[model samples]
Target: MPAVTADTLTLPRLPDLPQTATAWRPVREVVRAREFLEGEGFRVRRPFPGVGLANADPFLLLDHMGAVEYGPGEAKGAPWHPHRGFETVTYMIDGALEHRDSAGGGGLITDGGTQWMTAGSGVLHSELPPQDVVARGGLFHGVQLWVNLPRAEKWTPPRYQDIAARDTTLLSSGDGGALVRLVAGDVAGFRGPGATRTPITYLHATLSPGARLDLPWPEDFTAMVYVLAGRGTVGPERRPLDEGHLAVLGRGGALTAHAATPWDVLVLGGLPLNEPVARYGPFVMNTRAEIIQAIEDHQAGRLGRTQVPHVTAADEELS
Candidate 1:
């Protein structure tokens, strides 16, 4: 039998994103459970740390949340690290993070802000507590997601983007309560920041109880809806999703998300880059040699390092 593609497939349109069948797989699902820290002591929830659930091709590791209270000395952050052949996006919901990169990119991202780091070829960097913040008590609330890079761009130059809240486009329902911020694509007649790298749509949405939100997606893309702070039900399948969990919609177009209560959720979906993925020790690549080169560059002291930002008192208390 001949193979079928999106161009040859026809389907009815829905108010949501167009449906595209992908190589859908559970890969793995993980729950972050709070763990007690020794020493200065901080509450932390470790997610996808075990080898069993790092990241699948296309999708990578997802750290749902972190709070400074999770570590001692208000220093609740990952120190200098290396990554290549992938991208990392840090989304801040309620707190701030001192972001410093090896590609001459550094800044402090606060609430409603985002920092997108492209570790294309390679880079050495760290996400840590700001200098001014010190060891005082503070709130560190946010999520960091890793996205796999295409083989062609895996060894390209590394870069970073600090996406501010104001730069993002917002779409609201006619009733005026339900809304979403388009972070990196077009949706609801609104255009996002247009970040280059992946064909992606990152939407931050909120809905009131008994309200519904419909999205128009590309017919050739796979999508997953993640509930951050409420209950959500998708499709006729009636797949119920609650807070701190993820709902991956399979084989469909035009997603229907109904809120059981007032809730916050992030709708993220993108076309697969369609390339082999090989990852090792903060580096991702299509071939083993590429991953090795990334490590060699970091070890040879050829990678760049940016300055860390200063953290404010208010920033520390942003949990």
Candidate 2:
């Protein structure tokens, strides 16, 4: 279980949906996460950027870190690097990660906490396991998501949002069978603490066996759900889904899902930016020329300066 949890029976509840009142989003396709080695050679499960990302406009990538227990001196993390043209949201479900950036936005994000960094223009940053984690070793699990900014906001000023786990809005299902943690955006008139420039809904939900969740989602957003643990089904069609699987949903006014076992999942959706994307290394931009410009800017030290460990060609592909 994650460190942050609440008794559902004691929380406010979401309104129940009338059986015929709303259109439930249909499951369009499903994809499983593939193993990928990331920062400092730590393993991660990546579901997009290769699978069904065309529908993930405004969202660039999703990387799921482990729930693995680490032996002493076995934990690892991302070293110093740079990013631009988007935002990075890191959520710690079961451990800790420390962040520092040239933009002066960073802190230690612990269990159930989140770090939201807008790498507008550019910023040099580093993400590392706190010395204690590296020294004592413990269970570490988390997620990092790259959210693409609209072209208009790509050049906006850089910033950060440090949302503590307690700041997240907690709500229960109409029947009290499910617990929903709202990290960003709105739900049934309840708002999450993290303020985002683009319209989006980010949620982590836990359901008891046989429990169902019907969410009021924005009709204009592209939506999907990713299973973090256990077994479940998505959509009214009851498509089979489980750990490491991502189900893309077609447009609709709401989303419906059910848990076949104790289940944990991430439900997210965002307005599509619908713009051209040119990406290379750590930069994502509108055109190939812009990508080159970003590289040149970094070389010129316009993005910022920080001592970085040597990164090989393959490692640079982590963009």
* Candidate maximizing lDDT: 2
lDDT by residue (tens digit), candidate 2, 2-70: 747999999999989976778989999998888899989999998988844544877888999997899
What 10-residue stretch in candidate 1 is worst by lDDT? 1-10
Number of the top-ranking candidate, with TM-score as the measure: 2
Model 2 stretches with alpha carbons more than 4 Å out: 51-55, 305-319
Model 1, residue 168: displacement in angstroms? 1.7
Candidate 2: residue 261 lDDT (0-100): 97
* Residue 106 local lDDT, model 2: 79
lDDT of 1 by residue, 2-57 (tens): 00112211322223333344222221233333343422343443333434434433
- Tell me the lDDT of candidate 2: 0.86
